[model samples]
Target: MENFNAQFVISFLIIALGYCLKKWNILKEKDGEAMARLIFNVTLPSLIIVTFHSITIDSSLMMLVVLGFVYGIIVAILGLFIFRKEERRNKGMLGMLIPGFNIGLFAYPLVQGIWGEVGIKYFGMFDIGNAIITFGVSYLIGSYYAKEDVVLNFKHVAGKMGRSIPLMTYVIIFIINLTGLSLPGTVIDITSVISKANMPLSLLLLGIYLNFSFQKSYWKGIGRVLGIRYGVGLFFGLLGFFLLPVDDMFRYTVLIALILPMATSVLPYSVEFKYNQRFVGTAANLSILISFVLLWVIGNMIV
Candidate 1:
């Protein structure tokens, strides 16, 4: 329990420092975007590659991944029906935000830091579920809102997936692992050096993103949006934790992930769909804030 608190404090402090840097103008908005690109394109891919390469998989784990996808899509469909009478744009944003979890970008490092390599392995298994949700269902929702066709473009999905440095890195690593190939000392050294930057850089990007000027009138809508997000997230998280027959470790991990706020990726999608970006941004920020507390509480209970 004390260890959980210590870890939370450390992680929160680092995030706070990022906020401070952005507030102080030390990390300019433009620079932050550039850094975000680097993290998204380069550093993150490297980390994924390295981590995935070292993991071994089996049929059961693959089944879990499929289960996660189906579960996520089901949740999104439910959210859509609930929010259907609302504007198409809002419905779209809800679909994108609700089904997807930030398992890869944010959850990975935090879980790895707290639970070590084994924890990360658990997270990776969860990520397969996350990937399916993000790429499969979330994309459909986003496209729906954008009024794009519902056809599944395997080529397009594959292309976008290919450009994901992290995904490709993971694949490469997984191949090497399958072939029983060890990473050369120099490559390991390089990955170690770059991978170290993933967490701080991610937090910094988040902080910079939060620096946008929020409208006073949007506060009420933002509150409602957050209310829905946290409410559903908590319900599922607690239900999964207490009711599911999963192992203790995965139960706790999924609970934490369920509460992981909104992903920044939703912003561009919202814009494209003509939804309220301010609402999405505010909701995303609030989720981050709420997640800190939620994780602390859950960690104390489960850890």
Candidate 2:
């Protein structure tokens, strides 16, 4: 394989293996939940610690934080406007889905493989703002529109964001790097071993979670979600790539970040806020497939 075809090939093969495991009854889809837990708690944090430990922060990279945040907020507002005629519950469900990207599980693997630690560091900056909206603003949107009377406030959102292991890891490592401090060498050695599993585990998790079934009822809403998600993603991805004077990696990060799968939290939000679970799951799956294909095209173009 030339260029990124190597990583993509390995990724697809692992994902297929995972799906086959599920199909063969060796690993159930629910098994993915346990895998997800491990990834978030251990492997992901380890990757963050090891990757960010020695990388220098570019002042310009901070702009990714802003773009990640601003784009999420804008897409969210657009969702509401587009679905203004939708029911409160449906509107909130769809609106919340628009804003967030699946950076930790989806973006990190491809980036780590293609651009190595340098790209991971840049995407990490972008994810900080993405994390805020994923945990905070999206929660607010879902709760605000739920039929149940739920109290909404900034404190609640902050608490949620504070509890994110990956986000917390990012903040701590970023701060430590800023202060010119290093993690203890022993800690680095342990984390290095654990972090090696992050990418393969993430790719496998995606495959295990895949469901090829889609309902006839879902196409209408799913179409709306995907059409806007990619349509707007294309606009921003192109604009950022062409107009921004940033380095190629930063621009590429922006393009891919905007175009990634919807946030994993959207499914939980559906369950929590009493939206249609089937619809949310199907739409999210479709996004993953579409993003995979788009990334291939984008990768081939840039490489």
Candidate 3:
């Protein structure tokens, strides 16, 4: 128990360190981008391989995956109704923000620290569903609102997931798990070593990307998005806790997964769709802060 609390402190400090590094100009914004690339292409994939490699596959775990997809769809539909009165572009920009979870960067490290491989296994499957919605639904919404002709092709979604390094790694490991195949010991050792770097690096990246600037004009939009994201998320989480027959670990994972900060993808989506970047940045940063505090409070209550 002490170790879990200590892990939170260290994780928070690492994030603060990253923010301090940026403020002092020791790390530039481009450094954050580079760090992200390293994590996405290398460290994160390695971590996925390591986590998924030795786990026992369970039939019941599929529930997490299905529930993940269901949650995203539910929140997205909520966003649609909530933003129904706004202009198409405004609706699209705000609506896309509600569905995705920042599981890899934001949730993984803390979960790893506190819950070990058990946490990763559940969240990883949950993320599979989360990824589909993020790249598929969120992208379509953004592109659609931007007046782009976007088709929801199965192959297109699969191809997009395939092209993503972390997702690809996840698919390969999942196949191996299902087939009862084992990775070579040398391969496991190598990946496990590399995977150790993922947590700290991810935390650091969050700090680097955290922004404090806010435009007064966008405050209402930001509040609306945050309110929906956290409110709906918490409601679903508590509903799952009491209603689902799943064990405590499963319930804990669901609670944490649903309430995670905005997906890091929101920033690039804003850029690609030509929405206001500052607004997205502000909303995302605040979400990160909000999630951290909520985790601390909720973690104490439940754990």
Candidate 4:
């Protein structure tokens, strides 16, 4: 129990260090971009492979992948309806933000620290469905809402996910698992070295990109977005907790996932779609802070 609480504190301190490094000009804005690229292209993919390489594919595990897809679709529809009155660009960005969970860097480390490799595999499946929304659906929504008339290109969506290193690693690793082929120990050893960097680097990247300033006028929009997000999250959390027939671990995973924050990918999507980047950026940081508290309390109680 003490270890769990300690992990949360250490995580926050690392994030704070990243923030401080940026504030002191030790890490510039472009450095943040570089770090992000490193994580997305290299460390993250390695982490995905290392963690998932040993997972046994089963019907129950596969169900998490399906639920992940369904969860994203449900939240996106709700987000679109909730923000229907807004201008198209903002509407699309908000909708994208609501659905994608920050499971990779944010949830993975915390879950790993508390629940070990088994927990990661559960969330990893959940994240597979999440990858669809983050890499495909969200991109399409953002492109649709762009000021310029953009063609709806399904190929573009597929290509984006295809090109993503992490997603590709996930699919390849899972396929290998299904085929009953174990990753060579040398490959696992190499990936393990790179994967160890993922958590600290991810949190550090969050701190590097952290933007705390909230425009006075944007407060209303931010409040509404967060309010709807957590409200829906709480509703689902309770439903899965009391009603689901799954074991305690499954129920807890669902609860933890429900309360997770919006994906950091929203910042790039906001940029690509020409939406309000500051709003999305601020919301991302805020969600991390909010989710940390929620996860910490829940971990102590449930785990």
C-alpha RMSD between model 2 and the true structure: 1.2
Query: How would the candidate models be sorted by TM-score, starting from the highest?
Result: 2, 3, 4, 1
lDDT tens readout by residue for model 2, 141-225: 9989887576677787788888899989989998999999988999999999999999999999999998999999989898999
TM-score for each candidate, following the candidate numbering? 0.86, 0.97, 0.96, 0.95
lDDT of each: 0.70, 0.90, 0.88, 0.83
Q: Write the per-residue lDDT of candidate 4 for residues 131-204, one digit (tens) a residue.
A: 99888887777888776677799987898889878788889998898888897999989988998888899888
lDDT of 4: 0.83
User: Residue 4 in candidate 2 has what lDDT?
Assistant: 90
Off by over 4 Å in 2: 148-150
Indicate the worst ten consecutive residues by lDDT in candidate 1.
59-68
Model 3 C-alpha lDDT per residue in residues 1-303, reported as the tens digit of each score: 676788899999999999999999999778999899999899988989988897877766888888888889989989989999998888889989989899999999999999998888989989988987888788777767766555556676567767888877887898998899999999989989999999999999998988887788988999999999999899989998778888898999888888999888888889998997888889999999999999998898888
Ranking by lDDT: 2, 3, 4, 1
Root-mean-square deviation per candidate: 2.8, 1.2, 1.5, 1.5
